[model samples]
Target: MNENLTNAQNIANIVAQEVELMSALVQLLKKEEEVLVDNTPDKLETIVLEKNTLLTQIIALEKNRNSSLSQSGLSPDAEGMNLLFSQLSTSSDVQNNWERLLNLSSAAKENNRTNGILINRHMVRNQTTLNILQQNDQTASVYGADGQSRVNSNSGRGIIAG
Candidate 1:
């Protein structure tokens, strides 16, 4: 009925949708973890693509929510959101939804971090295997500004003579 109420509802809906997306992201991350544990790198590409798409959707929805908040003369920050909620008649429900959304976001972030660690571990293992196969045992090598290999001081002796 009231424009402010309508704006508040829109914001709520956006947040709820974001929470849904984040939930999906968490699921995807869990699936990725399973795939990683199984050493199924092939499945990861598809999962990554799905994650990127969900991320894009979440970003777009956030932009829309910000626009809605701005239109309602809100700052689009935490304080502004609190102020907006205080002004809304549905404050209690909206606040609850916001809290849930925040929790979901935090959980998603943690899951994503775990997935990243898993990925890094997989990469390191693969690199180590490759190095062994190549018979190159160097502490580590760095890429130079020109994208050339910069040998580490500890490169005591490469399996292959340079």
Candidate 2:
């Protein structure tokens, strides 16, 4: 099973990198939320494209994780990358899909509905995280370099911390 360990380790490494990338993208999305709440949509098209790419990366990671498990005879830990992937299965797909509904550019995508759902779910979770930070008066601590607090405000949506 050393080979399996090596393979699992390799896949785990890739999964970890992808997970980090997704986390950064999620942070970017949260920043976009802050921008949308306080600023104009001066370059929102770019945001949408970037958001789509993040979703693609997330889905790709999920597929890779599952494939690795099957190929390496390694049952993924229930709380490891599998758990991270599970978070994506939440409601963000709805929001992302809905966003596409308003964008003619995304109308041609077949998985628009699924993506809308995922994005919405993701935003909901992000908002919840911010809310917890706020309720505990930890906004400053969470918003490193004023990043957390500045981006906290969801413009009355109460989803953001600012």
Candidate 3:
């Protein structure tokens, strides 16, 4: 029973850490959205790096928590968490932390989706601008390969050669 209690406590601590990291991740996602909207590429790059590092830490914690759960003969899912909570003398803290983690995860997911939409919009706009520039370049045709001014017949303007 002591071993079970110890395992429960360890899981609780891991969950708490996960909750904290997830909260940070959620905040970072919010910052990412702002950076995207403001069109700050440099700040967005830094934020992406930070977000990746934070996500790595969260994944490590989750792996550790899952390993602990497995060693305690529990599945690494909600059922397993509930089982661990059942074994604990005071489960409220861990339970509450788990709930908070879930909420933060949902927020992060939504923010990421929004950022994706923003990125797609930017890409489409840039592509449209590039296409317009390319079309104009083809139609204008101001210079020839021999460095001579090439008059575009379609433009209805020719050199006076005065």
- lDDT winner: 3
Stretches off by above 4 angstroms in model 2 are 75-162
Which stretch of 10 consecutive residues in model 2 shows the poorest summed lDDT? 98-107
TM-score of each: 0.79, 0.44, 0.83
TM-score of 1: 0.79
Give the per-residue lDDT digits (tens) of candidate 3, residues 41-85.
Answer: 688878989999999999999999998899898999889998887
Give all candidate RMSDs, comma-separated.
8.1, 20.3, 5.7
- Pick the TM-score winner: 3
Query: Cα RMSD for candidate 2?
Result: 20.3
Give lDDT tens digits, candidate 2, residues 1-162. Answer: 676555555555555555455555655665566555554567667878887887787668667766766666545543443433333334244334323322432332424454455557768977888666666465445555344454556567654577
Give Cα-based local distance difference scores for all models.
0.82, 0.55, 0.86
State the lDDT at 141 in candidate 3.
48
Model 3 TM-score is 0.83
Better of 1 and 3 by TM-score: 3
Could you tell me how far off, in angstroms, the CA of residue 119 lies in candidate 1 after the best superposition? 0.9
